[model samples]
Target: MSYHNPVLLQESVDALAIKKDGVYVDVTFGGGGHSKEILKRLGGNGKLFGFDQDPDAQGNVIDDERFVLIPENFRYISRFLRFYDVRKIDGVLADLGVSSHQFDEADRGFSTRFDGDLDMRMNQKSKTSAKEIINDYSEEKLAEILFLYGELRNSRNIAKTIVGKREEEKIETSLQLRKVLQRHLPKAKEHKIIAQIFQAIRIEVNEELDVLKEFLEQIPNLLNEEGRLSVISYHSLEDRLVKRFIRTGLFSGEPVKDIFGNSNVPLQKVGKLIVPTPQEIKINNRARSAKLRIATIKH
Candidate 1:
């Protein structure tokens, strides 16, 4: 039931500007680290709702009168909250991407270091998996995910190799897929290359980017006046979306200007982007790529 220490626990909660009597949410309630901290700062009337789609995360649910864990994905934040009669919240916190516990568990196939099944669904109920994506996706489609999600430069070649190898033998496991793309893994760049490959498949399996966009689109309507949003993303793709959504209120393209030169955006950036200090990165290597962004409803 132990999950890695929630990234930016203190910094993210502090950014929420928690009101003792406020209602809040921890959307990625892995191990309940961030939710627990927010609970400590809340008054008797305060409430904290947690959401996690991973069935395994249910084991880490906290026992408290003020907390309720929603056994669902954060993308359904608005729908589930409505079931609780919660229309608007004071703050929402999301520690994006895979949890450390998921990466550490070899069977999850989230880490490149482990040799395991090609199943990378964050939710166990998910029908699509990394194995299916690698073994069934067309070369063109595979390349698209690798280039977009993995940010791999040689994505087309990597996809061609996967399609070629899977034709000979189905790529069933992590090591098997790695072997299929052996030529791409140069000695000096072995770790990075394999990681990118895995990342691309995992993102596809989970439809991560799509889920993120859906969740963010609901934030403005879900938050109360002055409500805060704190998100910690480990990759540029997620960070870029969060950054753009905060600044422009759209994932792509610029906001249209009105006759008065005013652009109507739903959210505003709270402050400068935040990243882990070198000291923190030394303690938790997972925090190395982490970037924190905060935002609030435009008023």
Candidate 2:
């Protein structure tokens, strides 16, 4: 599993409060790292289902009868698990954001440091790509994605530059895009700005935020009474959704109150936020921004 080094490995799994004989899931089963650890804690009767959309992950599938790797996105977690007669789960783990392997493979076009094609589709079969977004999307649409997803304030200027540059020659590679936005990238902040731009395009191409919302919406129904949810998010956008859902059971705004003035929240936050320790961050730089949150079925 050099494909990925699961962040918050022990802390995230411990958040599951794993039951020896209960069923569980690792929704982001990259490299099967977390799933393997879950199996180690499971008894003979325990079952663990893994979900991953990337075909590359199939290579790392566990050979245990107790483990089943579903070759689909976790947005369809409930539907796929039901195909196997599983209606409830004791715990579920999610390590959000792109896998280390995806970032390392230059051809996949995930890294800002690499000069590769503009393709950034997490599911290879998906049609949309960074190339399409950069070269085909309207200037307004491009600006919107950069502003919202990338958290960039000068997105309109960047979008205009991209459109102007592509008119002469199609922006086909990461370096080409970088050159198009040269004025925007100051030497001191070049890496941070480019990362934000890449993140913006990747999120839009993969519909990551939408998929996350859909997957989380099913958690209330998929979990058994007191079932645990352990999630590790690398960025603020994803973490906000998880935190809001766990607190209010809704992605936005306050929860509605019933006749008795009791809010109908479904999941209860289990503990304070968990971030990578200095020791862990030193060992794995990817863990630097990782934030782990745990929740369980609300009483």
Query: For every model shown, what is its TM-score relative to the native structure?
Result: 0.98, 0.99
Tens-digit per-residue lDDT, 1-299, candidate 1: 25867777799999999999999999999888999999999999999999999988999989999999999989999999999999999999999988889999999888888899989999999899898899888999999999998999999999999988888989888888878888899999999889888888888898899999999999999999999999999988999999999999999999999999999999998988889989888888889999999999998
Model 2: residues >4 Å from true position, as ranges? Answer: none
| Candidate 1 TM-score over all chains jointly | 0.98
User: What lDDT score goes with residue 12 in model 2?
Assistant: 93
For candidate 2, lDDT tens digit of each residue in 1-299? 58898888999999999899999999999899999999999999999999999988999999999999999989999899989999999999999999999999999999988999999988999989899999999999999999999999999999999999999999999989999899999999999999999999999999999999999999999999979999999999999999999999998789989899999999999989999999999989999999999999999
What's the lDDT for residue 210 in model 2?
A: 99
Best lDDT goes to which candidate? 2
- Single out the weakest 10-residue window by summed lDDT for candidate 2: 1-10
In model 1, the clashing pairs are none
